[model samples]
Target: MIEFATHRNKDPRLSFRVLDMTVKNEENLKRVFTDTELNPGFDKVFSFACLMWTSDHEQCLENIFKLLRSGGQTLVWFMGYNDLSIVYKEILEMKKWMAYLKDEPILKYAYHDSMDVKSDCYNLMKKIGFQDIISDCERKHFKDYVDIYDFKVHECMDPYVNKLPQHLQREYLDDVITVIDRHIKNDGLTFDLIILLASKP
Candidate 1:
């Protein structure tokens, strides 16, 4: 990544660092790039099934552009919000509750914004000067992708649940579990996963 960045800047003196953590603090970001040409920092970058949870997805995409070497590629796989096909009534109700929780200020950051830039990831990449953009959507039954869904919910949803009011936390957890169980039993859950590939120009 550093090599790619330096090459783009045409400066051998440039350097880069990859922090395996969320880039949320501008001060920390500034500190990390001191005395270096950090633009166009990578040859290839990838995010797997993770972009949907970000609050400022536009900013994130912009940063990714800044960090990519010219002609560098980016690959991202994320969930599509409107593509979930749920037939079970109980699961539908649970989905409503989940939506309500997502609106809460305390949990908003962890929630996925279905209509954010992520919804049109390919277009966003093109708008950001990316070329050769390719996007594909894959739909699958929840039972077939249960492992992935389980991991995502645990990683993204559990944290929010943990932060809820103590009195409500257990109840929420129970309800969510019940919904999952019912959906699995009835084969009522389905998901749409979108994959995007683009190259910075």
Candidate 2:
């Protein structure tokens, strides 16, 4: 995404900095920073399909707010709901998998089990001092079926699979794939996307 943004940027006025939020620092870039460190601050922040991977939604949102200049806005999009969440929850209940995944907080998506996601997010942003907040959850159905290989790679289930011995990795994956297969509907996957638009006041 950073590469694409860099290639497409034509304006000399715009500059970009990167932070790998999963780590404290990648070489010299920080995983977290303050607006004061940016001199004044950034005019906007955009998080796309990234926050779903974060375990701390509140702190992440707060960080985004702190990154922006006053009146600067932000747009964040993430997976609010997915069938794989259900699959993971079910798999976690299995005795064999439980031993490996017991300490894992596998549901990284914010409010994945919320009865009222929008309201919950709105309240969070409002409490964070953001103005003109808009939080919505929309369900989308993709045309193509989920490929097993792609699912294994993109779903980030390695943390669970890697805990077992190398010889048992394939067996564990097969078990997970079985659970995933049961959730596939009409040869496609449906996702609930959470879209948030807010401004730092």
TM-score of 2: 0.68
Q: What value of lDDT does candidate 1 attain over all alpha carbons?
A: 0.58
What is the lDDT, from 0 to 100, of the residue 115 in candidate 1?
Answer: 51
lDDT of 2 by residue, 95-134 (tens): 8878778887766456767899899999999998899999
Model 1 Cα lDDT, one tens digit per residue, 6-95 = 678775644556642356555545566543535536787787755655656556666666667788888877666422333223433455
Cα RMSDs, all models: 8.8, 5.3
lDDT of 2 at 32: 43
Report backbone clashes per prediction.
1, 0
Q: Rate the local accuracy (lDDT) of all candidates.
A: 0.58, 0.74
List TM-score per model, in order.
0.59, 0.68
